[model samples]
Target: MTASVLLAADNLGVHVGTRALLRDVSFSLRAGEVLTLLGESGAGKSLLAQAVMGNLPAALRASGSVTLDGTTSRADDARARRPRWGRTVALLPQEPSLALDPLMRIAPQLSETHELVRGAAFDQAEAAALHDLEAAGLAASARQYPWQLSGGMAQRAAAAVACAGGARILLADEPTKGLDALWRDHTVAMLQGVQRRGGCVVVITHDLRVAEALGGQLIVLCAGQVVERGDARTVLADPQHAFTRRLVAADPARWPRRAAAPASAGAPVLSAQGLSKGFGGKPLFDGVDLQIRAGDRFVVQGPSGTGKSTLGNVLLGLMPADRGVVRRAEGLHATAFQKLYQDPVASFAPQITLGQSLRDVAARHRCAWPAVLQHLSRMGVPHDLLARRPSQVSGGELQRVALARVLTVQPALVFADEPTSRLDPVSQQEAMAVLLDALDERGAALMLVTHDDDIADAVATQRWRLAAG
Candidate 1:
């Protein structure tokens, strides 16, 4: 007998006033099945997830019906489904930093979810929480606060909390964003575990590898409409839509290798000596010496929790090393040193519109507004998005805007901490092009952290590999 549908969305749409962000999006998932949503940045993929979760932003409106476990409810009435959030339906948000509570530690958060949402006893909840963290390879991070863990660690922690409620239907949005290849595979396996348990999973991601791995249903969206829908393996292997083809082609693994930029023969823009750092008494790296010359591209690669981001922060002078000295070239404006954070949303002022934030950056750095506009245009970011606050826009959109803002300062060096992690394949290519082009024009140096080996190979003039200490 055919299994019943566990989750279904009928003619779902999202809007802000008269502007349609998503239109007529629909899908259905049964137990032991997976549904993957694929699209470029700002293509309404996340909006669709929010519509089904009944968690759309207050400013935006949703329309349609969502059926879960044989109960149907209007998508727009968020309150009607509030009680279903954890045990029935759970959403693993795109930004783990924002999803986690700053004041709380990791283990307790999972335990609480199990206790409150799943109605498990205190002892069982605590044990289950520990087990979940261990399975996610975040056992060491169990005692750490969300802010204390690295971006990848926090992401895994967030996944544990999201699933602790034993929800039958999971909506995971970019769940593997900052994870390394090993952890990425681990996350996919975790999702597969959901399938083994006869639960349904809906994943929204730009990673083709994920969709191909899941090998279930796939839906491709473009400009707020479904351009294609079919089997994941079949569609990804032979995409009919032009946009889908471009997306598939844009994967970094398929990109042609370019000769790395030649070593610059000039004064070093930044230098560090005998650098060492650690987290929670664990040494990440030690006695690391480095020199970054103008126009040089340095890519840092390592497994998740190996302190890839910590090294970047240390080099950028954002955090002090346990033992190290960093020297910058004299006479360079402090503003000339900039960073693109791993989490772009946290970098912007949440209360203000994106336009106001960019305007402030332009004013502070004395960059012409026209230059900002030009950067935005070149990156394919529409001007109308500027009116929205940071949280109102898509993660990929905000990442590009962050890059544009960084370029406005004309920085002498950029410490890019997974700047393109949130972007789609196409947008990743475009954004990287703009960034490298701008850096080449300005002769700026870049120290980048990335989990994508293909991207690191394509972009790096030099490589820095960190090991777990």
Candidate 2:
């Protein structure tokens, strides 16, 4: 008997203006199977998902066939595919925070989806959808607004909504990004459960470990074309193509180890005493105190909802503390936030090139532009990228650029929040090495917040845990 194909994209192509985002891409998803799309940033992973969902932007054009339930069609047939769209294929985009509305309650969004997709009354479907939420590990989140939920909770809620709609084929873009290890494992298990129930799932990610964990089948994409496709384990273990080999070789878990302790003694660079923060009659952190000496690579680790990122924010002055004090012995400090808040396209003034942005930041701190450019080179950002606007760069490049800007300021203390969460393993290593080396030269202190143990173990001179009581 022939295997059933739940979804298939044959010879698909997508073009944004004159640039071809994806070309001649082909893949298929079967019931009870997961096909992970692995590639670096700018490899068209998200764009492929959009093309499959018929949600490509207005400026882009798509060709070839995207078939659901064995029915093949072009862009013009999108309307005909509408009724079966959400029910047959559901998409979970990157950045759940942006995906959800801050003002809307979770239940209302579910009710609205049910009404629009199934033509069912809100009251009628509320009970069943809540059951779905419970199964998806979001039982108590019904009444909460998006902002009220933790990052992991919000991602799970988004997944619950997709599954609750009875979608047979799930397209998840970076589903585990920014989640703690516990939540990441749980989310992957839930998706596996979906596959066990005879559903099809496709996960788009740059993290090879995520793909390895969700083993079924794999398709490696580079520059919009498939470079390798086979059993997940086999492809990863013995990759043939140069790009695939490089990806497998670049796993952060396999990176070379660096001595955790610094050889030199230096003065205390940063100190915090009796740090405390509370919200809604509950304490997020209580009397948390820590100090960092020069040459120290300190790491802060914690589970979701435990306020690790919150503590980072308070230290960086992005958010204020309810009580206690944070003091930096050195006047210079730079921070890379866990979440990307600034508009990438407008991160720098439209009129200014990327190089100018770097120069402006360097000048503000009395650093020379030549030194800044050299620093950027060490971070693997070519001078050509400096001539381009932030909008012209991919998410990973944009993040590196942001870090480059921070480095240009020549800070004596640096705080990096989940800096490698969205970066591919190779880029993560390169970025970390550059940042650490620069800090060492300036005798600066480093404070890193992350969920990855490998990262904590590799770079930290001191490690601390935040527990949820």
Candidate 3:
């Protein structure tokens, strides 16, 4: 197959405050091809995408030539190069929930894109947009608001809008991070269809399974530099760089198994009987029951929009259940959600440091701040990282900080919803190890919500499948 370059980044460099996020990074995407950007958390993967999209923060300074179809321009100039977006390029951000407007219907968004890109009239554009929506697996979601649609459905609608705009290059960041196997597979297939239609796709992801399934050219990044670049199978099966090899080796599926938990246990530390949650007449969880005893790691598995997150919310008292009762130990509970609830830029108080955030949570639970610092160090989070504000830290670092905050609480029961979704394989393994160790030491019970079977198999002492009732 003939290769035609669609986009290229030459010697891309970006600096956020005093920290150099990315430097001397270079890669290219071509029509009829999918290029996978593989990296751990905080490796500047997302920054690279934002830079490409001309959406980098104003505080950060960048120097690079991002070229589209043979036109080279500076970051500012490139952003202003219109007829650029929805025509030459498009972006599908990491979280569909954040990308979509909750109040707007999907069909209108597509129609707007058609009008903006193709100058089509309202009636003509609506018809063309509906056709594109159907092709993108969003036919049923045309009139649905973002909140009314599932994550997968919203993502599909977003892609349809991009397609309708006649974009030739698509950039997707962790597109399937929080989705299940079926949705993950379906999303990838939809992207592949884009490539087949003669467009180029660039996917920034931490999941090796996604890279493997997409069958793309793989480029590995670590600490803001390219470590490996080649065919997906070649790079994964026989990695040349030490970092690449370490990532492949760190897969949770490859972890050594621990002794199984005793089958017969004492009274359950947490229990839910006939839990049901619904919204706007749509039942999220019809009737789900689960039990967790001390030392038990129970995994709740299901596809996206199947109530995995709703179940977590119900457990945390953030959302009330319509029916059934959830009983927990008479103590504090800590949770880490699938999406980063805390603002990446301002999760910490402006006057306080990262260390203070940890200390505050520790003080609330009457725990020692020093002990929390020790745990953070053991988890590979530098002590100095505690001095940085959320705005200054990377996403991975922020997540680690959040995990540290949770640990300081010393809760009797913990609920983690896709805790490793945004983490790289190495960080994922490290975080899981710390969580399991702390739980084991405390003899606390855990209810983990995730779709990654490897994570479920690695950490779960018992497992339950939740389906739409």
Clashes of each: 0, 0, 0
Candidate 2 lDDT over 148-175, as tens digits, reads 7766667777876676677888899878
Pairwise TM-score winner, candidates 1 and 3? 1
Cα lDDT of all candidates, in order? Answer: 0.90, 0.76, 0.76
Best by TM-score: 1
lDDT of 1 by residue, 1-469 (tens): 1238899999999999998999988788898999999998999999998999898889999998988877888989888888889988999999998679989989999999999999999999999999999888888888888889889999999988888888999999999999998889999998998889989999998889989999999999988999999999999899999999999999999876656666855569999999999876889999999999998898999888888888878877788999989899999987788999999988998999999999999998889999999999989999999999999999999999999999999999999999999999999999999999999888888889999999998989889888898
* Candidate 3 deviant stretches above 4 angstroms: 1-4, 76-78, 118-120, 124-164, 264-266, 331-356, 383-394
Measured by lDDT, the strongest candidate is 1
**What's the candidate order when arranged by decreasing TM-score?**
1, 3, 2
- The runs of at least 3 residues in candidate 1 whose Cα sits more than 4 Å from the true structure, single-residue gaps closed, are 1-3
Please estimate how well model 2 matches the true structure, expressed as its whole-model Cα lDDT: 0.76
Instruction: List the lowest-lDDT window of 10 residues for candidate 2.
Output: 335-344
Model 3: per-residue lDDT, tens digit, 1-469? 1236778888887886777888878877777888898887878888887788787767777777787766767865545645587788888876565566778898898898899787899899999988887776667568889767654566667666656776778888877776778878877887898799888888988888889988778989898888899999888999999999999998878977655578565357767899999876778887778777887887888765677767877876778999999887655343322222322332456567888778777777688878988878867788987776665655667777777777776656677767777788899898888988887887766778787888887777888787755
Ten-residue stretch with the least lDDT total in model 1 = 257-266
Better-scoring candidate (lDDT), 1 or 3: 1
**Model 2 stretches astray by more than 4 angstroms:** 1-3, 75-84, 118-120, 128-141, 261-264, 333-377, 381-394
